[model samples]
Target: MSFFGELGNPHFRSFEGDIPDNREESIDVEGEGREVVPDATILYTAASFTDRGQVLVEPTGPVLGKAEDAPIDVVGITEGSRVLQINPQETGAEIVVIDIHHTTAQGEEREIAGTASITVGDDGVPTLGSSEPVEQLSTSIAIRGAGAQVAADDHIYLQYSLYEAETGELIDTTWPASPILLDLEGTMEGLQTGIAEAPVGSRLLIQIPAHQAQGTDDLIAIVDILAVHEDEDVDDDMESEPTSTSEPTELSSTEGE
Candidate 1:
């Protein structure tokens, strides 16, 4: 499938006509299509008509925290609010936004917004600019590895396996499982941690010091990077063959005679 097809479709739903003032008012979405549920981390782009009728654009990406914010972005909006844009660019028109408030993993209560982006059609979203090209680093053996290609100001999702410390075995059963957000330093740490020490094909497990494991003393993770994929376009100047200085000389009349 084409990369965009793999990404699917994206759509938007609103709980009410306005964006919520507090995080307590948010909503939940379920089933097929994009549903913005309470407490779900979401990024939203909204365009509203100002008193003069010019469109006012306000874009915010926020995490939901409470019931009052059940419907994220429920305030400053009303019925007949025009749908200006949606995310993921693949879901079609099947989007739902609810009004409620909720909290996040960090225990911050805030109003939530609803929007859904899915991978469904077209070429994948384009990553523009060269400031941050997709960065990748492979292990010496090419077995376990982790790397990421990021665009400026883009949120990245990182997933790695946590493992046992002594036996080099995987510890699949645990809380806060799956990949989480990594700060800039952590992102770099992920790229460099085991690339040198782990053998190729051997799963490299990094033991999270109790202080760094987010309050979990026994939590350890095995980062087994199956493969890393990236798209890079080489310029003509960088092509492999050297440029030919002169065209082949026409057959000499004297030689032929």
Candidate 2:
């Protein structure tokens, strides 16, 4: 007898009931004496499974502190630590956390936090986790001096040494290779000429052209006129001024003769 017939035949001690001819009817038994009852036709659902070893977690977005990730224990996670949940596919991924500190043009300190992911591409090129955006800096260069003076079409020679502003270390032996020259013409020239004629030891601000600087394109130099020498014609003027007379007059003593 077939296994199905033996299961249902009553006279057969092992199979005590009539076998249901329909192939659809079947009994599903769970743990001992417990039967799973279904309302409709039972359909077995199979789940798709994938094998993943261990996943290492890291910071994903912007990072604030220095700590990178949290320590893993069998029980659970530790407090005050960062944990990164990563996929097994990203086994060798690298994580970077950056804290950017910069000084603005207005002399203000700016602190920022950022994070990035690193991976090796198929062509052996290294790529970031995300696109690295370009950053623009609002900055100004400061040129400091006590005083400056200049005249229209007048040539002002700057005699000073260049040094690193921050470290106060001498950068060049003499003044910068190219001295800042100002052409007192139009609006700017008139303004500078007035400043030049003011006095010695004068301080002034001069805007130089882009091409004149040795390495820089645009710059403003604070000029201090340490000394001034005016051109004078002393030789020709000495003979022109009238001289006082102290000669004795000859009296007419012929009258007495």
Q: How close is every model to the real structure, measured as TM-score? A: 0.27, 0.20
lDDT of 1 by residue, 12-101 (tens): 223234332332322222222223333333222222223222322222222212222322244333221222222221322212222111
Candidate 2: tens digits of C-alpha lDDT, residues 176-245: 2222222333223213433355332333333323222222223232333322222322222111221111
lDDT score, candidate 1, position 209: 39
Report the number of backbone clashes for model 1. 74
For model 1 the TM-score comes to 0.27
Q: Model 1, poorest ten-residue lDDT window?
A: 1-10
lDDT of each: 0.25, 0.23
235, model 2: CA deviation in Å? 9.1
